[model samples]
Target: MKTCKEKALEWGISDRSVNNMCKTGKIPGVMKEKGVWKIPDDASRPVDKRVTSGKYIKRELQEEIKPLPIGISDYVRAQSEYYYVDKTLLIKEFLDQKPLVSLFTRPRRFGKTLNMDMLRVFFEISEENTAKYFVDKKIWRCGAEYRAHQGKYPVIFLTFKDVKFDTWEATLDKIRGLLQEEYGRHRELLTSDRLVEYEKEYFLKILNGNAGEVELTASLERLSKMLCTYYNRAPIIIIDEYDTPIQEGYSKDFYEEIIGFMRNFFSGAFKDNKNLSYGFLTGILRIAQESIFSGLNNLTVNSVMDEEYDNYFGFTETEVQALLEYYKVSEKKKELREWYDGYLFGNEDIYNPWSVINYISRGCIPQAYWVNTGKNEILEDVLKIATDDITEKLYSLLQGEKVVARIDQNVVYRSIAEDPANIYSLLLVAGYLKTPKKELQMDGSYLCEVSIPNREIAAVYKTEILSHLLQIGAITRTTANKIAESLFANDHSKLQKAIGEYMDKSISFYDAGAEGFYHGLVLGLIALMDNQYKITSNRESGDGRYDISMFPREARYPGIIMELKWQKDMDIESLDVLADEALDQIDDRRYDADMKNDGMKDILKFGIAFSGKRVSVKTNR
Candidate 1:
């Protein structure tokens, strides 16, 4: 055995590194004597991992991939600690077009916050010269004209991402706290001779966080002036997720109060402030111009349909392909595309960045990562008061059908529930729907043919619609569970009784047609067992099209086939006879033949008859 110093000399590394390895047990068969490490002569060098070299360790270990970043918006940490997809070029694109005030509206978790941070780091005139963060990134090669803007201006970056609150008072308090924090970053200005006495008083009030409502309302405009005084240059402003508070206010009962304050608050800083060089804002929806950007004429809004900066927010196919190739999971690309791809930003195809990172970092198991982040409050709210026609359209979307509507990109939140097209517009901007094809009408309106973007978003609609049914008492979890249990146990009477009761409660939307309504009801009920059953509908099997088929992904569970007939003229007494005839039709058509071919040994068939709110069920095993 030898001291760590001897091993360091032999391995041509620092003695401290060897001592650290010994202390952390990375070096095997080493012991400590007194205050020093004694290393075994036969100890081979462990691979150095102290510095990230754009390559991870071998894929055979328990942690084959680097840790996935969650809720991390710092560009430096994200690039250093994890496998980062380079979105730094977003900075270059912003510099190239340098809009006076640019507002980008994209759904949450689409790298908006992180991209904002990248802009702050690139543009803020700091003494540290943070160009090291973008050393080898794509933005570094966009030519010197673009690179010259790096660290060239004073920047005031603030994110209203967490300003969502249930009350106006609480929301105001949070904004005051954020302003105080930003002021603390420049507290050194308090002693500068450049600041006049009155300006100093206002700065001190904001810095101490004891400002009145009037002062707090004008905080951003005041801070911009102060920053200009201190730096001798106007500062660029970046506000991220700017509409979170407005959306929350509308959901809660304080929309007018919040809007009144915000209209003045934004107009003060952005409308005609000479201290402001430019501004940037990002959110999920563009609250109407008259509502928020009341008098800001220089503002530019780039929504999902805009061609400028289309590839900046989400992952393009080329970017996703590069990431998959780096992780050596190229074969999983098709599955990832099916789940996370299909978002259309401008004319470019985009994938959800959050879902893609999680899928690769979690061993490539495809899941609805983006959908499970937060409650779909906005979507549920829209569904609560949706008209019958809108409800039918939602059901069609779940069935992989396309919905066409004239979408107004600038949404008026207060009046969204009044128009069905507004609901489709909300879903489109909120990242739930995507247009695979569109046409420009002669009247200057876009005829967009939209559908659920991908499987992940489809799962979101399924979960939310199921919850809506439960909330309205159209169905109950106990009844759903009972149905699954009875189907598995071949308890025909119990399952039949539950279906009749559920149908009776869910008959309000039958104007679309009895067959379609009953079909949607049964489909929603079966979706509850989606984990165990791969349910399909209106597909060719044997010699005819079956209404619904629940084929167990696991062969252990029995296959289920359901046939339904709606009678407009039958009395309640003859419903049983109609149900028996439906059963005979299922047998005559050999609906079970497909299940048999698929190697399902146990099969259960159900025939259901519906008349108004009454239902009859008969089964064969």
Candidate 2:
């Protein structure tokens, strides 16, 4: 029998992992004595999926699908070991146009980082024989025009997706670690006769992770220059999720420090750096000008709304159909489309590849896979501090309705709070919202009609954003229960009194002049009955929009409709008349026509009028 350490060394897994496996009884015939494990001499080496490595192989892997490549974004391993969708044509398309600097922004989990890694493998002059991984891929058939560029250039690939530090100091340390790893790859530069002694010293400092802040900031540009001199070719720079640090900083109260550092770092590396042949960046949002890309005029941004390169990020309908067919679940295509295939990128309908893959891998059971994979803390943070106007629009979106807004593809993080439109713009880039119909204006701007993408995203809004609204609006369980009790009993007076008390307590709700504030509050109150009623908002059944409507899912309970009005120029005495006017409008407009058409009997309609903290509610049979 061999000890645990011996078994770990033989199997090439960590000792801790081997110990854990032994403790969990995964390893057969293992004996423990005096705190040491004795593993069997002939024990098989169980598969180690934690790390990827082999003798004399940096990225080589055996072809199999036993351990599925769920989150493996590395092109080398994914191509060799997993069921890979051929997105290699993305390389051909990118090379065909060959923009000087390209920024492709898509929502998270749309294969942005994986594509960036593919570009690195294809372009970087490495000894991994990366071309062999793409032998049967689509890019291989694009002829010599594209094939000639493979393994031809020096490449600098960096992903800043994990630089989420609380302080600028920790952020710098994280960046230094990444730089050190990169610099270690080119450590032969220290012995190169062409480089000066001081340059060698600077490179050594970088590899040791002891470089000064200034040295680290200029590290990329310096590395590119060094690589150009070594390889006699300008390096292709690819940065993945480049805006992650800035986004985190803005949400975490260190925006200025990060932006200042990144602006200088990017300007030095990208602006007028002769060592750069071309650069590619992938991020969730294209941060606005005068921030990161200051004075860089040669940059080209291709957002989700852009027609060019739209098919490169997400899975197209045909691609998803083929994927389902390959898995022999072709009959489930419709179900998949309804849940995950509503993302409209330009004119093509796209599916969330991450969610679809997980769904298939998990026996074709549908789930909110994409939404649950990561924390939507950034979005929730922004919404918690949202003004009344933004909250109302968000409520409309939650109700499965569209809103027209001027979408700025470029999102400025610093101004996101002050500018309400920035919230919509950020959500658009982050995949929380999608534009169905977009019109280009004469002034080079876009007027977008945006809404929630699909049921999955709407589920996220309901769980995360709506729950936050409930908390911010101070609609507690007691309050929600009280409101529901009043609605079920059709007690308009008690409901009005309860709502007026709530409005009085919330200073922001009372002070908000936007009509949506009152509308959203009523909707939020009704949302508490989501378990008991099929609540809907702004459904067009009559001549005009009805503010709120609730139909009990079971026929035994009564259906309810509500119309809300804001008394703009009225005293306390005028509220009753305004409330009566609301009731008259609800009947005159026939707002309950759809509910009645659905065979809903004994519908309860309520007209609610609001003037600041005073609420007047009237119900009719």
Candidate 3:
């Protein structure tokens, strides 16, 4: 027999993939012995459904479909070699607006880098007549008025998307390296007669990576001036993922240092610099409150809430439909929409381009493809300061309910912990929540109703968000699994024991006396059963509202209803009576009516009481 690791190596797949295949019976003669998967040595790799089902096989003479650009951010290569979506119209929009300096704030992996590169390829003077890249695109048909600007100016492009470091010193070094590379791109400046000896000396210093922090901070302004002097036209500057280093600083305990450096650095490049023709920046958050763009009055900010360039950053429904049609998988459109669609960028309904590409590339198996792309630090930060009210609202959102919130476009990372309400603002910009309805407030904020975007985000919430909350209390995974097993088995005694153990270990005495606390605790734990049950809380059933309800998604699993009660200074006997009272309340109010109406025959009603750290659970099995 061979282990899963051996099979993974032979199949050129991950070990986890091999184990999952065994668990799902995708491979024959696989067995688990002592928690280790054993597979037959001669077992063949499973045939991919996309290949065998004739979905990708051509029976007659037909053009083969081009590969999707999964993570390609290089515009020249992506447009030439892959199934490039026509985003060249972004150039037309920019030419029409002609903003002096534009900052686009979008979530990660939404084609920010690619769009920026597209702009770079369009405007930057190249010897290869880069206009050919856009000749077949939508922008080319817009007439020569837009095409006249192609390859007209020198462009200074730098992407800080990968400059993630744990220390200010290392971050500075990475920045220096990036500047050195940008300087290397414009090597003509070293020999240009337009630049004086002193300017060339500074240029050489930056190009050779021997520049200090002061020189590096002044690098953009210097390079733009030299390029302008040589080309007799002001240079355009593009910075991709500009806030990556800033986010790293905030998370890595070097916020002030990075913020201070960025202030001077951005000021030199953009603030009152006549050498700059047009500047562009893209990041997840605006970070305006950090003073990074201070005193740049000419700067125009286009966020997800803005209507000017909404559809440019992400894939629209039409683009996705066309892509699906081209791939001959138009039937998967509904499933793709459920998993990857539902993002609202202004009035345009957008889908995550990254996840959509990944879904199609991976045989249309729907999962949280976008969630795995980056760390969900924004959600983690929000959960750390979550109040009881915030917790309840989050639980409601997880259960597919909408809640109203005020979204401030200028929200910063440092201010998130000070005001928990800013969590919604962060969540919206970071693409965790979507605003279906919004009204502009007088203070430049939006009063919006926000909810989880789609099924993929709901799954991410139940797993990442809930798991992080449990981890904060040092709760073991075994404890969670035990609770889920006990509840599913209808073993009220085991469930009661599990609840008591969790409360005893995780809850503080000061936090246990409130009924709302217990409600939140139980709701968080029950949220883990999302795969099997459609979890709901504080929803009206038949006659009244139930505290928590688990309507099983399948008829095989029993429906669950939990009624919680808490009182201060209650002894064990009083707690027991309170538990029974809770059970009576559930029955009297007919909280199980909705479950019964839905044809759920096996219902387990749990009445849970709490006083201080003690818990009593009584159930009508």
Candidate 4:
């Protein structure tokens, strides 16, 4: 029989992690005395018998990697009725040994904070009150020994996401408040009787918001040691959003100062404490060692390239189908698979578990939906950093050619200047773009051109931004329109790149299809034109169909009808073909059919063909 302490060594997991598993009945262990818990016999038995046996009582929930309305303490148990894929097995594999002291990583929404939360819920025991609420979930049904390990180890969980302090003092105070709050809850579990006076005064000083860094570090150390003494167990620690402070604080010196505190603070917790069991951490970026995690070692990083645990935090295909079946959303199986199911978390193809569940919960099939779960602060910086390269790509779009390149999904947050070869990689990794398909090449690269996909983003890029011309702060929308028209009528060549760059800067630029590209160019061209008329879509063109209609200032005679063509898809004579098509569409749909009604006579039309950077604009006879 191995004591709980010994199993921590054998498994190399944080004490809190092991404790959670044991509490949830995922591991085999038992309580022999009031203070002693032991794991006797076969330790491989699962907490959830159905999951371990490759069968689910609620057959449809095997895909729900994440379950139920989160943070609702009342709904603690893993709801077997809701879809939840077993990630414990995946995590058990990911943490085959002790993790590195610190790790920074970038994953899509489903991959970031949620994974960290899972780590926190699994590892920490000091806050067992929170864990107590989850004891009845599906995963805790049969593993009796696990239930025995409850209330054993001490754990600390801190998240950098909520940090909004502007000064070092403020930041330290915030951390102190958090630590004190946790300390206040488990003061009874601390057995540092020898340092009783020191700990009490430290807690008081922190409560008063006047704790010094030296004293703060010392207090945290005391808490760690006390937890060790009372529980007769080592401390386990997990941090969520570790890189948030550094990222949100970028270009600001306050960030580095705060980083200095956290770096030293965490190093002491994990390094100075010999009774420390293990640690697990998650954040968007792996800050360079020169700055973030200065002296800490012994961290085994599990990142995008680390494929061993790819399936640990994401939704798998099988899981998706199972969930659909469980929720009786089977009808949406194919649609969900196509839209939100294309992410890859290693070699395993994964889906957006969040989107899938949201759709199921709201009883709606997948659509453009709630992709805005994350704030675009970092995304804005990425855009500002990518102005030049993004501009070039926008120019390429005008040629009706979707830019293609090799991409490393993590390079979006990379510390390097924008490079031409890395654009696609940066975009795809940043979640602003995605690869619809991959074509492998003999040269050890992928022939993939990443692009935006969804009605919401589509409307954003082409509709709103395109409908108006950009302006300086002092320039009103009307004045901006005047300047834009003047710029267009005078010089379109320079204005083309200007609009491309502007669109890239201001919009969620898409890999516009042929029709989309043509409309984008038309909009750019119009931005430099006047704002005298409404920019309407599909007016009197057959039964509700027209690519676009640009009305000019005042009541003009014949409004312009700009027909379009992608010559490469057709032939060199396609211009003539488009010209003929425009004549027919214009006449049949009566494009000028309402000119008389509008107190106008003539009808203006243009046929445009775009190919590999050159645009041929011709007018109707």
Candidate 5:
């Protein structure tokens, strides 16, 4: 007889699959001996007739491919059942540093929770020979010094990723429940003779969900101490998505309540806690001003801007290439890179793991997968408080241009509204923007040239970020559709009316006095046509720079150019003359030279003039 592992090796499948075959009686002579599957050495591998049918050959090909771990966060299951990327080297990195407390800040769905769970599985003491899980992993390939740390300590793991609630009472209740579950994980403490009576009582209070806010605030310190007493070793505490509740608190108007509770709660767990052997935390933002990690002299933060442990959070270039090769879709490399491969984590070029996996699972079709994972509250907030300068810069960004901004890694949520410049910092850490060039200032902040990461983010900017403008009634959908249709059809009259109507409704007198203001307004409106055109702005073509240009993605659409002019206190007659002069300038400067050079035969040029919410448009078709 052969064991499940042996059969898995012979069939080129996972042991879990062989074990499932035994459980389902797919094998002829399988027996359970000592709670382990015993299969005949001569038994043939079972095949699903439905999947193997010639009519379903395509489905069979899919079945032969290992399933992608779309949302699987469990370490053992992900590595064992799915095509797991070997992130076990993260274990090696952590062991080398051995900081007392480490906080990792990354965007959502970048495998933060899964990585934290992996750390827990690697370090937490288990009785079921957990070493087998890592025997074939990268960590085990390292020397004995690293392997010796496997399953060596008690671990207290908590994930506040789902602790979102509108009221403080409800959020606290959810937190208490999470704490109760973590305490229940260590039920052996109840019967340990090493634990004193008082410690056992406190453990029971947490286990039974009878612990109030006060007890829960100090729950981490107390539980770690009791766990140390029981195991005779200090415990590792891991908190995943620690900022979720804090972000919810800020958005739901319970900011003060959550911040106050977290200050004490985190302080008890990480700040100067003797019971903690090592602490690990993962969140989207650092939330430094809240004093959550204050006075933790040993704290080390690995943010998106840091070089240490950068490759572990997101998939590096080599990793994605291997994934593509494994799935037999290696030909999609260029498309995949163009859509999802522009994220910069520290100095490493990274791909969005969430989107890449989803793209592969969906037959390599590309779309904005990451944007739907959560609400874009940060972008919405930025749009809500955007000043005229900020608006113009955002328009420029959408046109595939970079903007210079200060990036402070210690940005807090409360300060976003206090100082709108913090929007750049928030956008960088949240994965919406990437910094290709950064120079460190004396203030410990980076002055970065930031732009949209990839085509996916550009699409997201048009759909998600611009949709906020519609939500706030900045421009009507009718106006947007009118502008898109008019531009596509080369109907200058309808385009003129659409721009006039949008300016009258959305632009204030103070906002229409500058060419930059009108430029931004027109850019936001024309952005609706992005699906059909590759929009660019302020590019040198022919003899000079044109204000805006739309290069058609397909030959069926016409290439477009617009030169905008604005003057203070202009009469209606003068505005008309200004519009005509703008059109004459586009021709005199030969702005159509770019599209012509690109083999475009049909091109349209428009000249738009704006003054105090009044607008005039003229086009040469």
Candidate 6:
């Protein structure tokens, strides 16, 4: 009997939050009011029994999960594990198995270190430990099975993530420092007969100025042997982002030295340490697998291509919905999906938690939010290697082909345009894109098209240059009005000419006569400007295709319709005939189908002609 607004208070949040939750596909609801709240006939959300751990939002803190005192760390901790995301559980499951070595390969910042830290907290035992900290979580509740195994193994975690090496010497110094720390921690086992062969050969050099490659390597071997001796079993070897140092290390002038030195250093500990436990090495690129890990035959590599635990990293649809409901930010779902919900990874329907969390926190889906946080080093790499064809295709994708196979994982540079999986991977990892859902292709391979995931990312490409309007410094209030005036002309040619000139100068010099380029340019122009900017789809006739389209995001600005021509083949009467032709399609193709639902009918005419690089614009009253 209650209205949507009245019922909203009972749900513990506002109407807007409920609506957004529905849109994000988080909490289910129906839109009863056009611009107001959705009246949820039933509010019970079904629990998701899928791969994600929590049915609701992911809570990061818990009281019983001990405040780990093992590291030189900061105290501004997150809510101590009230609920963990799927990635956390996956890592836990993997380590629970105690594999010899496991490597997690993801692009930068997919929570590699944080997940590593969770493993460090649970597995790595403290000497003066208490049984008090592990009680609240279910891991402890696994009862006698879990507790009996507690503190049973010595864990040695080496994090190369924070290590910065501008020079090979710096890298060597860091490695030596780590060795010294490890040796001091395991001094008792270092005295064992099995490991004693390394004290004179390895430690003597740390005391002296000269350390050989063999001695440095022998020290790691000695350490692994020591870990086995102390724990009475092999250690849990977890190496987080182990390959990052190599990637960053070589960008400097010392590539060969660092790689060669690192290869030898790691080969000792990783190349089958006799007294060793299993090990894990993670990094960005595989880094020539044969070159580093050498004979560590047990090493299992998990990159984006491997579908074993595809749902392990990114958020799933149910999780996304639950988070929206949890945060009460569900009112922004339609806005959220339009920008971010488009990437697909294998069979798992996942979303980027990083971007969505950021958007929901702000209460508005920003355009191109991911771009600001992403690394453009690959972008630089892409531009350098992009041939003319690749450049044109990127421009083509802008027009909405939902391109397949535009990227290849193996060929980082050349692969970006032909491999659909790799294209989304590059875009998602780079933060220039996101995974919205899982789409099963006819060919049996799933594909995720790159979309401007969230407003946090979409607002980047706006200019009269792209739409063909000349500007002074930036797109100001005056320029925006003038462009609106141009659109009001309803002359597709005028709008087309405007965009043609803009793209030729600002976008790319070689896109002349490229229909895909212009179509995308128009879409870019409409998407840019204030949300009120208008573009009427399929305006009018002889004007072909439906005439012109207008998008008015605000109430104050009048809509614009435009018709574009590749050449000047018509006189004024001919223009009218063409315009009439396009106007007819408006009704046939339902051009104004949705726009009319908003009640807007101010129409003008414009014809734009493009001749090579020349843009001739004309309008009719």
Where does candidate 6 stray beyond 4 Å?
Answer: 1-88, 95-99, 130-133, 146-148, 163-194, 200-222, 246-266, 284-297, 305-307, 310-346, 355-371, 383-401, 406-425, 428-621
Model 2: colliding residue pairs: none
Worst 10 residues of 3 by lDDT: 55-64
Better by TM-score, candidate 6 or 5 = 5
Sort all candidates by TM-score, best to worst.
Answer: 5, 3, 2, 1, 6, 4
Assess candidate 6 and give its lDDT. Answer: 0.52
Best of the two (1, 4) by lDDT: 1
**What lDDT does each candidate get?**
0.81, 0.78, 0.86, 0.52, 0.87, 0.52
Which candidate has the top score in lDDT? 5
lDDT tens per residue, model 4, 1-621: 655544543343334545556677666456556665667644753434344433654442343233443322111233222334555443344344446354535454554555555555655564335443234332334355444444455776666667665566666667777776766666564345645666667656765657778777665566667677667877767676766665545544476676677667766776646767766677655554434445556765655434667776557888887777756768877777656765554467777666666777776655554355544444334334444345445433322235666654334243434454555554454444445556666754467765553333332333223333342121235444543654545433443334334433332233324555455445454333433344444456544466556555455323556555554444436645664665566556666545446665544555555543334455552
Model 5: what TM-score? 0.86
lDDT per residue, candidate 2, 1-621, as tens digits? 877766654453456768888988888899988989998878997655555456423332222122345898998777655677779898888888988899999998999999999999998898776676665578988898888889999988889988988888888899899989888888767878888888888898998888988788799899999988888899999889998888788777888888888888888788899999999999987875546888888889999988888988889988888777766789999888877888878787889989888888899898899999888975676676677667667767866678998888765765675676777777888888889999998766679999988878877876775467566665555665666687677665666566555544543445635466777666665445544566667778778888778777667677778888886756757988888899998899999888889987678777777776667777677
Cα deviation at 78, candidate 3, in Å, is 0.2
Residue 454 in candidate 1, Cα distance off native in Å: 1.6
Of candidate 4, the 10-residue stretch with the lowest lDDT total is 71-80
lDDT per residue, candidate 5, 192-224, as tens digits? 898889998998898888988888999999999
lDDT of 1 by residue, 1-621 (tens): 877756654454556667778878998888878877887767898886675444443422323344656778898777655667788777777777888899999989999999998899888888796876675578877888888888888888889999989999999899889989988887877988998999889988988889977888798898899889888889898899988988889888888888888888888889989998889999998876446787778998888888888999989999999889877899999999999999999898999999998898889998899989988986787777676467666766776778787777766676666665578878888999998877776764467999999999989887898788888777877777777776677666676676656666666434435687677677766456655676777788888998888777776777888999997867867988998988887889988888999888888788888887677778878
Q: How many backbone overlaps does candidate 4 show?
A: 24
* lDDT per residue (tens digit) for residues 1-621 in model 3: 988866754554556768878998999999889999999978998864643435435531133346788889999878766788888889988999999999999999999999999999999998887876776578978998998999998999999999999999999999999999999989988888878999989988987889998888899988999999999999999999999999999999999999998999899899999999999999999988889999999999999999989999889999999999877899999999989899999899999999999999999999899999888888788878888788889888887889999999999888888899999999899999999999999999999999998898888788876577567773567777777887678665776677656655555533544777777777676456666767788889777898988887767677889998889878989989999999998889999998788877888888888888777778776
TM-score for all models, in order of appearance = 0.78, 0.80, 0.86, 0.58, 0.86, 0.60
The residue pairs that clash in candidate 3, if any, are: none
Alpha carbon lDDT of residue 121, candidate 6? 56
Superposition error at 115 for model 2 (Å): 0.7
Report residue 20 deviation for candidate 1 (angstroms): 15
